[model samples]
Structures are given as structure tokens and as C-alpha cells.
Target chain A: MLRELADILQAEELCNTQGDNVQIDIACACDLMSDVLLHAKAQCLLLTGLTTTQSVYTAEVADIKVICFVRGKRPQRDVVELATNKNIILLATHLPMFESCGKLYRNGIKGCSEV
Target chain B: MSEDTTAQVLTAGRVQELVYELKIEDAMVRDVQTVNVESTMDDVRAILREQKISGTPVLCRGELVGIVSIEDLLKALAGGETKTLVREKMSPNVVTLYADEPLVHALNQFARYRYGRFPIIDRKTKKLVGILTKGDIVRCLLRRLEMNHQARERAHYRPGHLFEDVVSDKSTLVLRHRVEGSNFQRAGEASSRLKKNLLSLGLSPDTVRRIAIASYEAEMNIVIFTQGGELVATIEPNQVTIRASDKGPGIPDVELAMQPGYSTAPDWVRELGFGAGMGLPNIKKNTNEMSLDSKVGEGTNLRFTVYTTNPT
Candidate 1:
């Protein structure tokens, strides 16, 4: 499921390969850390356009372990380092937010709010 | 030792740790009742009666001289010396505690001296600061034990079960974290700590998430906009309250700042993914009650509360 999810997003691995085999059935797509905090469920994969260290912190607090930066946004070295330290998986894709969510949805990854 | 005896020893060890960790100032009563050394024994009796306390400290020219107990007053009355000065009847060899000393010292003093109360004094100035009784020590220990119990109950109990046996009239857990302004690396450290504490208290996942989000947003605002600030989360039985305050440049237009997409953040902040103008709006959306007050040149204060039950 993890490899399939990454393949669907056409994401490049940035850090923490240990979660590559973990199952991730839910994905939350958002750019704002605030929205992610408010709506993100635990263990969900976060797809965002923002590539800041705060993004990693938001995921850490929300219990999200994997993040795929959409819109081809590669986070700075510090951001990647923080995610690695927190054991969070990081990925990057050239697709925008809507397309990334669409591709993942088509591949059987459910949205966080879906039943 | 048997399993049961080991468990008893562990509990006793924890209590010992608490006494050493807690300071005398934490258990002492600050508003102490006192009597002037020149005051007559009759004056001490009236104070003990009005304050419903058994003893009062005697002071001379704003300096602690002795302690006058009800027994001292009774002796004065029986000997027909009710009009005698407290300086003559009160015990002059007073035993006092330093405010900064550990509570364990106070406990040892109580056991060794068999005294009813100890007047707490400033270590450097020798000025009386507070009064500590056995009752005060007990109350302080009980309150701390309750907090630790809730944290430990998470392992064996379901969410919300810790509150069922809470007998205290009011119990609150306060968590405070300092946020450094513009420190992107440590922006959400405060909120993360708050979330961890809330989870350990056996709160529902949904409630923890809401508080975490609201606090995270508030923390980000401080890092992005101001010099720095502090985030304090107070968890109560019915609600969780968060206060974020800073001494940075305050908002000039609160009404406009509340808008979903309004922001004054520099382009550099935007590039880091924050300052999306969604910070305040996101906080408002997640919290049940919210308020923000700011003085342009002074500071800003933001307070929000989230209810634990029947959230709408």
C-alpha cells in the first residue's frame, strides 16, 4: 500500500524509508498547517503544497507519519532533517494539490472524511 | 519482597519524591494572620477566634518575635493575666522555615518538633512570608497525587474514566511552554507538548486534536508575527482553556485580521508555508470560544476555550 501510494503520486523519497511498508489508507490534502491540525486524522498521509518545518511539526502533533509535498515543493534541508528525526516519511511530487488528491483517490486511497 | 509489598514500596517512593520536588512556598498560606508583640493576650484571643485558627505569629516593629498559641492565651486567662502583653506570654524560641526549602524539610520539622504551625521566612531577609500547617501540606500532596494519578490511569482505563473518581471540587492541569518569535525550527513545540499532556490525561482523541490544532495555530502566529510569546493550556473537567500572550508588535486592525485571507506577513514568511492568512481563522474554527485583544505598541493577548463534552 505504501509503495503503491507513492507510485500514484509520482513522489520522490526524501527521508525515512522505514514507513515504506506501512499501510496508509487515508490521505489529507491541504496547504495550511492549521487546516491539517484541525482535520487530519492520526496516521494519515499528508499531501501539501507547503514545504516548511512547521508542516513537519503539524504532522508530528497530529500523529501523521508520512507527508508528500505536492506542487513539486521540496522542503529545505532543515525540514527534511526534522522529519527524519521525528521518524516521519517525506516525499515530493510535481503534481499540484488537486491532481495529487485525484490521483491518490483514483488509486483507492480514501479521503480522511470518507466513510 | 512479595509483589504486593513491592507495589506498596513503589507508592511510598513516589510520595517521597513528591515531598522533595514540592517546595515550602507551594504549600504555605501567604496571607498569614499576625499579632503585634505589644498587643495584650486579650487581643490574641480575639484574633484566634475571628480567624478560626489556633495560633498567630507575634511581630514587633514588622519583625517576627514569637508565636502565640491558644494554649498560651488560655494560660493567661486562667492566671488572671488576660491584659498581659503578648511579649511576655508568647513562646520566644520560634522555629521557622525558609520559603525556598523543600516541603520534605517541613514534614521532618513537623515530625520532630510536634508543632502545629511553622512560619515561613525569607531566607535572606529573615522576614515572615507565609504560614504552613499540617493541613496545608496534606492538601498540597492530595492535589499533586490527583494529577499524577490521572497521568498513570491512562494505561489501564478508557478515555474519560479518570474524571469519574475525581472527588476534588476543582482540579486543573496547567501546561506552559515558551515560543520563540520567528524561530521556524521550534514553532509548534508548545502545541506539541500540550497535545502530549492532554493525551496522557485520557482525553478523547478528537478533543486532543482540536486543542492541538488551535494551539498550534496560535503558536505559529507568535512565531510569524511577533517577537515571542508563551502558551499556557489549562485543562479542566468541562473545558480546556489556552492563553497565548506576547510582547511583540500588536495588531492594528483586529477586525481585518480576523478575515480568512488577510495577512501582513512578509514574503519570506509566506515562502515557509505559514502566513497564509489562515492562522487566526483556523484557530477560531477549532475552538468553541475565542477572544483576541491587542495594543499596537504594547502587546497582544489571545484566549480560547474548547469544551470537552457535547461539542457543537
Candidate 2:
């Protein structure tokens, strides 16, 4: 995906203090921290409602590149600032939780299917 | 009478009202016994043993001044100084919270600060009235699970069904499922099962983390939004891939959908404590790469990838 397109999909831009030079290919959405720790795919975007520092930590541990916050929820200052320092693309949207995932679905993003 | 419609009607007991009643008060401990600071070492030990308490708040004339735990007493005794005053060995910092605040907030505080116990104080009077223990939170989780089970039973929803394993690897596993929209309760069951499988397969902790986060997020979306859906996961040597595709209402705006604190889940879902608008963001944060594709009316497909590198 084009860098600009990825940024647009996430509806976010790099902060002045950081670089937005990166890429992504898949996405997952969830609120349960335990489930995310267990099932996230590689080289993917994570969508979630959790805004704690641990959420970002989980992302780093999982090696996710982009983070999209669904339902207009904003992360705490520490979370946003932390993502900035970590070079993670953090974006926000006003779409409801499921609709947001649906929006991505309707666009042609294929999942990492076992078949 | 149609059984499907009848079932829907019967199972329509609102989850919102139920969870509203579950608001944090029941999870809080309302009364706590405290000890005087002037109490001798022997007296403090006796109180702890008698009360089966690990720690006690030390008060000076009705004001909390310090805290003396059993560990402190043991250390003092080991040093051959049981006659020392409780005030001398007590820890001064006392973490506290109000009785009426939400239990979730208290739990967050506990996780953030690593506090094993917290004093519940009156916000207006500044008087210690209760104690909040880790045990209290565990009890609350048990209650929540029990209530969820009761709600599921009321809905006549089966716990696990409609999934078949299609692939597996040293680092990943895949499953296929043909899902119907109305059976939302069973949606994340596949992801949950895969997580259990990963544990059984002895996937590294890093690899398991990637797989679990991606799968759960996709599974939850399928359950909540799809009228009917298919789920597929690919486990590669270094990463895991999960996809959920649905033929249902599609998203018109990808930008708005990725925002945090946003949700369209009914009050019922909110009450069930399921939808907090963190699903996608949590998945994104946990994975190394992600992509989203959707359209209005045609259908939706969501995918996730989680990568693992050998930990140092």
C-alpha cells in the first residue's frame, strides 16, 4: 500500500517529532486484551478500544505497525505520545466499532486465511 | 408461533439495564478495620493473626498515618526487636480510593500501580471506611462471568459451535467457519479455541501473542456486525494471519470507523460489557502490520498479521 494511502485509511499523520516512513498489510480489531495477545496476525493493523500504555506495549510486543482507534475514542496523552516515539501510526475515526471494521472489509482487504 | 422470532423476543431481556445494576458498588469493600499506631509489635502481630489480615492501617487519633504489614512485623521480630512500636516500622504511603467510584477504575489503578490492597476513603470526610483487595476484583470477575453465563442461558445461545480447523504450523494455526449473523454469541469462539490450541502447540510466547490478538479482534467483529461470515487464519513461520469476511451491512466510511471511543453497539452490548470501541485499535496496537478493506452493501473482509522475532 502507498504510504499516503495507509495514512489516509488510518486518518492520521505523523507527529512533528517523528517519522511516518513505514508500511502495513493486514488489520485486526478487538477490545479484549487477552484475546489480542493471543491471536493477532503479523504485519497488520490493530483496531481496539483499549487506550492504556499496555495496549501500546502489547502492540510493540506483537510487532504491529499501525494502530487505528475506532469509535472516536482517543488514547491518553501518554499513549499517543508513546506511539509517536515508537513510530507507530495512531489514527482515530468516528465510526462505530463494527462499522469501522466493515468499512475496511468493503474496501478489499483480504484476511490472512489459513485456506 | 415461529421459534426464531419467539426466541428473539424471549431473549430480549436488556443487557444494559442488567449491567447498570452491576455498576461498581457491589465490587467495593465497604468496611475495614484499622489499628492504632501506638500498638506494640506484639499487639500488632496478635491483631494480624487474630483478624487473618496481612496488613493493617496505622492511625493516629482517627487519622491514617502509616501502614504496618505482617512482613514488617516478621522482619522486626527476626531482628530480635518485637518490643518496637508499630509506628517505627510502618510504611507511610497509603493508596486509597472512594467507595462509590466505578470498579473498573479501581482495577485500572491496581494494575497501574501494582497495589495489592487499597483503602477506600470517604471523598468528602477523608475517613477510611473500607478496603479494596485484589480478592475483591477476582470476585467481581467471577460474578461477571456468572452473570454472562446466565444471560447466555436466557438467550439460549450455545457456547461453542460452527468452526473447523484447516491448518496449523510451528508458529500459527488456521480454522474455517461458516457463521450465521444472528448467532453473535458464538462468534469469538473460534479465536478462543485457536488460542487454546496455540498453548497446546507450544508456540513461543511472542508468536502466541501475535496470533491471539489478531484472531480475537477479527472474531469479535464477525460476531458483532456480520449477518453471516467466514473466518480464515494462516499461521506462518514468523507470523500469523486472520481474516473475517461477511456478507452483511458494509462500512461506508473507513476513516470514521477507526476512531477510538466510537461504537454503534446497542446499549445492550454496552451493558454486557462487550463493546468499548477498543477492538480494532487493540488489534492494531498488538500486531506488526494491518490492512482494512470494505464496501457498502457488497460485503466486508478484515485481516490481521502478527509477527514474532526471537526474544533476546
Candidate 3:
């Protein structure tokens, strides 16, 4: 499902990670880091549009394994380095928030509530 | 049936006019990835791998010295030469495109040579401004045809429609930014300033964020592509109007360019995380109204407006 999600999002891998073979149970998308920090489910795929290094920091604190930057929002090299050092998988996609979630949902991926 | 032909003829004529008018400067990929002449073969290979590109222009100082391809690297690797510098082995004789040349010149070159890419150098400066590939030409042509049609239809657009033509020169707070082409490091300075001004005016946080993002993305576009330009922000009591105008070729396909992930920026820019093709779309999405006016060879003019809740 991670591999399939990568294809569906046209995602580019930023570093060696837990590997794309891991199944993604829930997906949470938002641009605000505070919202993610407050509400994210553990081990969920975090989708965001903010490219700040703080996004990686927030994800690290929230215990998310994978962070996908949707709408073609590429984070800075320093941010990627931050995520890489923290052992978080970083993926970038050209898909907008609605459609990215739509594709994943249509493919049977669930929201954070299910988790 | 006759009416359809008439509409098609008008569109075709407009497209042809645009094709002849559009030049290479506007659509070429700026912020090119290059290997320094003194760089080691290993360094070149690392750059190629990191950027996911096959070849890159080699530079001595700031001038383009040559172009080195993956084949060059492969041959060197196959011969067990692992430590040679790029200057010793790069192809000195390189083909280049002048920014002022018509778009067809590049199309002909692509058809004739079928080269993967050609470096675009500024005529007076002889400095590398961008790189062009066959894909850029095809993308430009297809997008230009459709966008040119749209541009013609938008000929009568006026920004005053939103502001009721009530702007007073003394009351409007005007800000200007000078953006240098391919200057990635200093891209967001203007946007930062604009954000500060917006916040100082007591605008809502949501409104401030949208305006800041739009201004920053537009500022990035100018920095990433263009021969330096000025961004003018005219702030009124109720709205902030940002107009970005630059020197050089203008955008050929405003619609396609506004699409997310449709970036023509070089891979190196993408490597740094700026060229996601989300700049224009995000700007459009964040603003209440957006308009683009570009001349093929002359330049580009982009204007977007964000309504302020804290209108004083």
C-alpha cells in the first residue's frame, strides 16, 4: 500500500526508510503543524503542504512514520535532512489534498478515526 | 458547421500569432544545474545522482565552459578512471541558444540535432541564464496555443473592477522588490517584508497567511526565472494588490504553469525544494482574483489581489 500510495501520488523518496512495504493504516492531511501535533494518530501517514523544517519536527514529536507533502510542495533540503536524520520517510506528490485523499480512500485506505 | 470553422479559424490565427511572437527566454528552464570545471569525476557523479539528471553544463568561474553527459561519466568509470576532474574531460565545444532567438529556432535545433538539451546564455552577459530541452519546446507550443487564446479573451480585464477605481496615490502603500534571475538564495525577502506590513496593519491571521504565500510564490517565480524584475505591491485599505513585472521572455502557458506539479524549473531547483509547480496555483488559490499578462519577448506582468478584513 505504501508503494502503491507512492505511485498514486507521484511521490519521490527522500531517504532510506522503514521501506515502502509497510502497510499504511490511516492518513491525516493538514497544513497547520499544531493541528497535526494535537490530533495525529500514531504511525499514520501525515500529509501536509507546509515545507518548513518545523513540519518534520512536529511529525517527529507526533510519532508519525511517513510524511507526504502534497500539492507539489517540496520542503527545503534542510527539512529533508532533518526528516532523514530522524528516520522518517519523506514523500512529495503533485496531487492536491482532496484528490490525494480521494485516491487513497478509493483504494481502501482509511482515515485516522478508524485507527 | 460554418460557425464552428469561423471560431476555429480565429483561434488558429491567434495561436499562430502567439507562436511567432513567443521567444525562448520566457519558457526556458532557469536555475540550471552545473558542475564546476574543477569538480572531480566523483563530484560530478554525485551531482548527477542527487539531481537525477543525465548531463549538466560545466562552468569555469561564472561562464559556461562546456557540457558533460552521463556517457562521459560512464566511459570514464568503465576505463577505471575515478578521480579525474570535469575540466580535463568535459566537451569544450558546446551548443548554446540565445535568449532573444525565436522559439522556432530551438524547435529546429531540436529536430536537427535531437540533443537532449542546450544551454541558454544571455546575449550581452554571456552568462548562463537557463537550459532548454525538446520537452520545453513541445510543452511551450502546446501550452502557448491554448494560453494565447485565453490571453486574447482576457484583453479587457481591468483591476479597477474590484477596487471601484477609488485608489488614491497618497493613501496606497507601495512596496517594490528587485528580483535577480536564478537567484535562489534571496527569493523571499520581499514576501517577508510584505508579510510584516500585512501583520502590522492588523489583518486577520488567515488573510495574512494567504497574502504572504501568494506574494512569496510570485516572488520565487521571478527569482527562479527572469533577468531580474521588480515586484510592486500596492496596499489599499481593503485589499492588497501585488503586481510582479519582469524583464525578459514571459510565460507562454499561464494555465499550464498554474497547474501544480507542472514545473519547468531545473532539477537542482527541485532538489532544494522550491520548484514544485505549486507557486502560481497556490498564489491563485490563496488570492481572491489573479490575472497574468505576458509578452513573449518583452516580459511578464502578474497581478493578484487579497481582500483585507482589517480595512482601515
Candidate 4:
């Protein structure tokens, strides 16, 4: 599913590893780290616009394995290093957050609560 | 809509609501450690070391009074004040954090104060419910990244598209090479043939590189370990799939052999430094997906795929 999402959004891998087999139980598209912390699952695909070391830290704390930056917002090198150290996959996509979430929802992806 | 208007809407649509809605309670630690105000500096130092913490809030009869840190302890000890009470050394002007406040507010405090941790006070009870640290905030935020990679397992369905027709298709060419055992000098013959084929087809540099690595590794494995094998490379519109099957003493342990540096090659093969046992592992690493099926005596069938235009 992540591969499909990447293809749809024209996403590029900012990090080296690919979680091709990693199961993403839920999909959340939000820039607010607090909301994600409140409602995220252990195996999730994060789609957000915020590109910062704090964003990467927040995702790792929430146990999010894959993070997709929307609207072509790639994380800085330091953020990439932090995510890499934590074994989190980072991708950047041209699609905005709403459209990315909408496509995933249309393709049977759901929020963590629904799953 | 105008391009500028579209951009403005995207930036403006959900700014304020998201900014004010997130609070410190969502990510703060609830169980806070505190030091009593009357405790001696030595006692405070011991607690910090035992807990492996940098600091803690100082409490006096259930009322939050001040905050103390390891730095404070060091400063006191440096001044030869081991007998001084924590009340004398702790920072009395405690910049407390409210759980109900916006997380950004907490972030601002962290930036402004340069403190390692803050004592979080519950809004209604007005008492310390938890400790908020920079590490804690990082952890909480990382935990919230929503990653649901529920990709449907569609195996290599890339038929050429209209626009991509001009660029090229991987399906146009199919090449096969015969590798004979003991042909040490000609071991890389098949791999070079496939490389020439891929390069001639005008494929992407990344795709060509991946195919080259997998094919070369596969070829080396066939020549070094097997009686002989046939190497085949099939190009499809979207990806390249390579299959190499040998007719020799089959690998009894596919998993173990797939590990790097697990070569069962004879002393001669090792002396050649050609079989460092990385062939199979290299093939697996270069390809996006790999499947290996083998029996004790029959043979081994190895297959891998590399996407052409885009990385899978």
C-alpha cells in the first residue's frame, strides 16, 4: 500500500531503507504532532506537511514506521539522520495532505481507530 | 481559481484550529519525581544519581515550591555547601508548565528557558501531574506519525502506458545464456551479455544498475556452486525480472546459504577469492523482491525483479 501511495503521490525516498513488507495498520494525515500522538497506532503511515527534526522525533515516539511528507516538503538532512537512526522510513510526495489522505481512504485505507 | 489563491487557501485552510487545539497533556509524563524542599544537597545529589535524572521539582507539603537540577548540586558542591538545604539551592522562581496549555506554549518555554525538563501542573487540580522533557516531547511526537502502509500485493503488473511508450518498455527483449560448470574464465559471460542488452535498450541508470548487480551475482553463483545453470532476463514494460536455475547438487539450506559469507565453494573457489559467499545475498539485496526455491538434490531456482522507471 505504501508503494502504491508513493506511486500516486510521485513520492521519493529521502531515507535509504524501504518498508515494502511493513504493514501499515492505519493512515493519518496531519501536521499537528499532538493529534497524531493521541490517535496513532503502532504501525502507521504518517502523511504530514511539517518537515523538522521534531516531526521525526514525534513520529518515532508514536511508533510510526513510515512518514510521507506531503506537498513536496522533504525533511532536512538532520531530520533524515534522526529518522534513520530510529529506523523510520521517510518519503516526500507532491500531493497535498488532503488529496493524499483522500486517495488512501478511497483505496480502502482507514484511520487507526477504524481499524 | 488563481494560482496565488489556491496557494493561499492551502496555507490558510486549517492553520488556527490546529495551532490552538494541541495541549501539553497529550504528550507529558504523568508520574513526576519531586524532591522535598528541606532535603540536604547531598540527598538531592544522591536521588539524581540513583534515578539517572538531570533534575526534579522540589515539593513542600504537597505544594510545588521550586525546581532543582544536577547542575545546581554541582554548583553547591563546588562552593563547599554540601550541608545546605535544597530550599537554599533550588530555583525558587519555578517556571511551571500547565497541562491544559497549548503544546506550542510548552515548546516556547523549552526554547526560552533552556531547561532540560519542566514540572507539568494539571489545570484543574493545579498540582504537578507529570514531568515534560525534550526527549519526552520527541518520543510523543514520533509515536503520532500515522503510517499505514497497507499496500496491496500486486506482483509486477506494469504493462506499458501510452505516454511511456516513447520512453521504452522492459518487455521488448528476452535473453538467455548457458553457463557451464568449471568454466571459471567464462563465469561472467552471461551477465555481460545481459548488461549489454539492458544498456542497449536505453533503460534508466538505476534500473540498469540493479539488473546488472542481480544478474552478475546470479551468474557467479551458478558458475561457482552449481554443475551448470541457464540465466534468463525478461524485460517488461515496467520492470526487469531475472531467473537463474541450476542443475547441480541443490542447496539443502537456502536460508543459510542466502546469508553473506556462507559459501560452500571448494578451497580452489575460495583461493580464487571469487566466492566470498556474497553472490546470493547481493542478488537479494539488489532486487526489490526475491524468491528462492531449492531442494537437496534437484536444483535451485532463483528469481528477482527490478522496476524500470520507478523504484518499487
Candidate 5:
């Protein structure tokens, strides 16, 4: 069952982040944008804390649906604006990286098939 | 009217309240080392040498403070005398990451910032934990590619599957010879032929694009660089992959070969409007994935892949 992106973002406490309603199936959590670029996984949500235009570029290149910024650190205004323009979801939470990932995992968001 | 109002309200809500949960941390590296800002330059150099390290975090009173590197030491040495002081030369305001952050976050941070390494810290205690380097990220990426290749092989998808539509079962090993260094005016023969064959097979537009880009880049590299080489085009149902292995003098610096704005092509190649140094970059840009293996004085082999889903 597809859940509402806004619901997930709020539950994760990442609500002022960009991705709100975009659908994500699997999760591809990595700090390295290059791996995301080379890895082919569909409908995957990107979990990261990177705040840069390159993160947006990587999302565009890899076709990621959502970005979850961990550690409560928000993206720069330009980054959020870019996501808005691209229709890519951006979300952030205060949870540390491991806990954030675990929260999603417990909720049934698995990594991509190859992970 | 009520439904339209509801739609507008929902849309506005969507804009303000999007959330995301964390996923798996893709890459992890241990044994990252650090130095203290108060340490002497001698100590810094010794630490770097002992660890075989290029960059090190400088800590003060167990708090992340600055970074010191070979560049700093070299700069100090080049400017005047080698100052034994570490605090005087260390780079302040270090960019950092949390220990549990995802690799994608680190990748962006490194790429955008051009940082060689990041000090990983505990969020609450903010204690310095580990360091994530470019090497670690690249390692993760290479591992991912290898895993993907293994999976494809298990699925009976050899690299050659990219050209199955054009080559056919009876014509797999044949290499069509184009003129050696034949320029772009004569560039698209191999590509056009392959494209025609794919078009006849009713390949999707995305597939045709992959084949076209792969073949075009490979063909151009052959014509522009080598004394002469054959153009090989291969196709498969899901992927279009190209291998352009040439006997050109090869790349002196393989890393620079991949970098944009660095090219060894002749003036004539540029005059013909070809060598803008965009050949390899374009190949990399067009393909969904790529890899290069080259040895100086030996040869260069460029491997390019474009999926049917992503196009050429």
C-alpha cells in the first residue's frame, strides 16, 4: 500500500523538508552521490543529510523520488527551492542516521533489490 | 465546489508537511584517524606518515576543531621555515558528518565541497568518531557496480547483450572497420547502421538512444584518436552497452583523461569542430553508467552503458 508522503514526512519529523507527497518504494541510503548515480533502483527514496545543489543533481540523474535529510539539518534555501522546482520531495528529521533508517525499516521501507 | 476547495487545501498541505524516514546506511568505513590542533607540525607529519594518511582532523579538548593535511605542511615548508606549530597551519572550520549518516549525504558533501575527508561525530556528545574519505565512497560505488554486474551475469545478461539486436546470432564476432581517424563527417556510419537495425527491430526510442549514444561516442573516439580502429555496436533487450578498446597511444594520466577540459586532440580535430574535450564527458553524460580502463603506452578501453529505461 502506498502511504501519503506528507504523513511519512510528519511522522519522521522532517516536515519542512521538500519531499512531501512523492511516492517512494525502496530506500537507497548513501552519503555518496556517485553510487546513487551508478546504481539503478526505481522509486527509491534517497536518505541523506547532504545540503548542496549536487544532491539535487544526483536526484535528477538517478530519478530519486524523495530525499530524507537526517539529523534535523535542513537544506539550504536554494536546495529546497530546487527540489520544489524539480518536484522532488525533501524531508529532514532530528533523529540520528541509524535511528532514522531503523524507523523506516520498521515501517517496511526496504532498500533496493540489489542492496 | 467543495471538492475543488478540498483539492486546493490538500495541495497546500502537501507543500508544507512532507516527511521522510531514514533508510539503510549504504557505506561504512572504520579506522579513521585524527590529530590534535595543539600537536606540533612534526607530530602531524609523523601521524600522517604512520597512518599513510593525506588528511587528518585536528581536535582540541576532545572537540572537533580543525583539519591538517599534507598541503598545509607543504605550504608551510614552501613559504618559509617549517613551523613546528600545528595550530598555526591547520585549516579551521572543518566540514563534518555524523557517524550514522547515509553515504549519499557524504557523497554530496564531498562532491560539492571537494573535501577529501570528513570528521564523523556523535550528534549528542559531538565526539569525533570516524572519517569518511573519497576512497571509501569510491569503494562503495565500485562494489555496487560489481554486484550489479554479477547479478546481470547470473540473469544471463552478458555485456554483449547491448548489441544483440544489431549483431544477430550469426554475426556476433564481426567488427566493422571504419576509416582510421575518419572524423565526425564520416563518424555516424556505424551508428546509423546500428540505429537502422534497431529501428527495424522496433526498439523503443530510449533503447535507440542508448545504442546511438554508445555507438556514436565509441565511433568518434576511434576516428579522432586512433590511427584506425573498428566500430563495434552491441544491443540487448534491456541495455545498450559499448566497448571501445583502441590501440591509440593511450592516456598518460587516466584520471585527467576522465576529467573535463583536458584533451590531447590535434588542432585540426578541434577545427573540424570535434574535440571540445566533450567526447568522453558526453559519453559519460549520455550513458547511465560508464567505466574506463587505460594503461599509458598500452591502450585505452572505454566501457559505456545506457539502459532502455534511461535512454542513450
Candidate 6:
């Protein structure tokens, strides 16, 4: 399911490739770290435009396993290293947030609130 | 047990421990009002009205003999026996608690025997030492909790004062990180390192997550707002305390800033996917206790504590 979701978004895996076989049924798209902390649940896939180290820390705090940076935003080297050290899967997609979320929703990936 | 029942039990766990820790003498009224055994029912009624008490123990020549209650007095008055002696109407078999017994024993006695009050007696001297009512227990517990809170407040102000009294070898991990203003790239490094350290310390995942979230928000605030600040986390055996202090351009109105949707952040910070005005609220939500102190033209110091023993 994770590999299929990544394909639909045309995302490139940046770190933690072992999580490619993992299943992700719930997804939340947000750039704000506080909103993700407030609303996101554990094991959900995160889609955001922010590619700073804060994003990786937010995912680690909220227990989000995978993060996909939309709008073709690639995080710096240190951010990717941090994600790898945290064992969180990182993906970068060229599609914008709207298109990325739409593609995932079309392929049976439900939003966190919907599920 | 169901989750709800388990939560209820855990919520009452502090009071349960308090009852076992306190002695009956600590909460009992030391000066007990008494009436002589030979006193008449009219005298008992007057004593009850004057003392504002529902019951009084009857003493005979410096010895506790029985207890005269408002119910006994009312019964005598209705039966036209208002002149009856206190001994004639008093219940001779009085249930009493020993002064040295734990307060939990008194609680059990109160639950088992539906009495409104219990006379406490000294075990060695066999003398009535005090009287205990349900009100006394409630007041005692409340006072003790207040004292504990005050002590914790004092410790918070002094930071490491709680560890001073410990002669035994205790490991306290101190983590300090400095932040630079407007540095978005390294905003969460402090909290990230803190999370790893806490996980290595074998703290529960829930507690570690809470501390991490709180510290991350504090760290981001320093990065986005002030000229920079220092975040210090002191990890103890039972709790963790975090202090974030900045240098200049302090907030004028902290109460307004604490609101959920209020933000003074510039457009650049907002463009970085932060400053939605939920950072402080998120910090408050994750930590068990939080305090913010700021003075205009001075600086802001935000401190918070997360209790490991009781994860909220």
C-alpha cells in the first residue's frame, strides 16, 4: 500500500526505504507542525510543503511513520539525515499539496478525519 | 477493568495514598466538647445548639462513658422526657478510633458504620483525645494537597532545590541547547536531541512524546520570535522540567499571546509553515504544568513540567 501510494504521488524515496512495504491507510496533509500535532494520529502518512527539520521532529513527536513533501520541495541534507536517524520514511513529490492529496484520495487513501 | 473505570481509579490514587500516609491524630479536632453523664437532655440540647455540633461525648468523672446525639435529644423531647439524664438517653456503646491508626482505618469505619462523627481515643492513656468528622477529613486532605502544591511551586522557582536534600546517588540528566533567531533549519534540534535522550532513559513513550512536543514548541518560539534563547531540560526520576528563556523584545501582554489564535509573527515566519498561533497552546496542552513570565523591554521565561509518575 505504501509503495502504491508513493507511485500515485510520483514521490521519490529519501530515507527509510524499509518502510516502503508498510501499510498506510490514513493520511493528513498540512504544512503547519502545530496543526499536525493537534490532529494527526499515530502511523498516519503526512503530506506537507515544509521541508525543514521541524517537520521531521513533528513526525517523530506524533508517531507519523512517513512524510511526503509536496510542491517538489526537497529537504536539506541534515533534515534527511535526521529522518533517517529517527527511522521515519521520507518522500518528496513534485506535485503540489492539492494534487498530491487528490491523487492519494483517489487511490483509497483516506484522510485522518474521514477514517 | 474498563478504561473508564481504570481512569477513575487512577485519578483517586493520590487521595488513596494520602489516607494511608496520614494518621487520625493529624486530622482530628484536638479540643472535643463534652457533656457530663448526669447532665439532663435539656442541657444536651443547649450544648448542641451552642456548640453548633450534632453530637457530644458524655463524660463521667473524667472518663468517656457514652455519646449523646441530636437524634437522642429529639426523641426525648418528643416523648416528653426532656428532663431525662444524658446517660439515660445516650448510646453507651460508642464507636471510636485510636489516635495512632491510619486515616484510612477511620475512612473504612466511617463507610462501614454510617456515623457522622467518631471520637478518637489515645491507645495508651485510654482517654478521649479528639473528635473526627467527615468534614475534617475533607479539609485535611485539601490542606495537605495545597501544601504539596506550594512546595512544588517553591521547587519550581529554585529549579534544583528538590535535589539538594538527597544524599543518595541519583542521576539527573541536564540538557541545554541554544537557539538562533530566525534560524528555521535548526529550529527543532533541541527537542529532537531531548526526545532521543528521554527514550534512552527508558521513560514511557507517552511521557516522552509529551515532553518532546512541549520542548519543540518552546524551541520554535525562540527561533521565530526573540533574538534567540536557551532551552534547558532537567530530567529527574519522577518528573522533567523545561525552561526556555529569551533576552530582549519581551511580550507586552502574555495573556493575549496565550490565546489559541493570537499571533504577532511576521509573514516570513508564517510562510515557513509555523506561527499559526497554536504553539503556546500546544505546549500547554502537552505539559502538565506551565508558566510564562514576561516583561516589556526585558525578556520572557517559559517553564513547564511533565510528571513521569502520573502521565496526564
TM-scores for all candidates? 0.57, 0.34, 0.37, 0.34, 0.32, 0.57
- In angstroms, the error of model 5 at B107 is 63
The better candidate by lDDT, 1 or 5, is 1
What TM-score would you give candidate 5 relative to the actual structure? Answer: 0.32
Chain A of model 4 scored by TM-score:
0.90
Off by over 4 Å in 2: A1-115, B1-174, B309-312
Error of 5 at A55 (Å): 1.1
The TM-score between candidate 2 and the true structure equals 0.34
Candidate 6 TM-score versus the reference: 0.57
For each candidate, report its DockQ versus the true two-chain complex.
0.36, 0.06, 0.02, 0.02, 0.02, 0.39
Alpha-carbon local distance difference test for all models: 0.86, 0.65, 0.75, 0.73, 0.62, 0.86
TM-score of chain B of 4: 0.45
Q: Which candidate is the best by DockQ?
A: 6
* Model 2: how far residue B268 lies from native, Å: 1.6
> Taking the tens digit of each residue's C-alpha lDDT, what string does model 6 give over A1-115?
6778889999999988465578899899998888998778778999999988888988987778899999999999999998998889999999999999888888888888876
**Whole-model alpha-carbon lDDT for candidate 3:** 0.75
Candidate 4, residue B81: CA error in Å?
A: 99
The top-ranked prediction according to lDDT is: 6
Number of clashes recorded per candidate: 0, 88, 0, 27, 30, 0
lDDT of 4 by residue, B1-312 (tens): 543442233234233333245578877888787889889999998999888899999999999999999999999999999899999999988888898897667766766777788899878899889889867765655454322112221222332232255454332557788988777655555765676566556566556756766776677678777889899887766688888999867888888987767777787765443456777776776688899988878898999998776322
Model 1: fraction of the reference interface contacts it also forms: 0.68
Q: What global local distance difference test value does model 5 have?
A: 0.62
Candidate 3 chain B, poorest ten consecutive residues by summed lDDT: B155-164
The runs of at least 3 residues in candidate 5 whose Cα sits more than 4 Å from the true structure, single-residue gaps closed, are: A1-21, B1-312
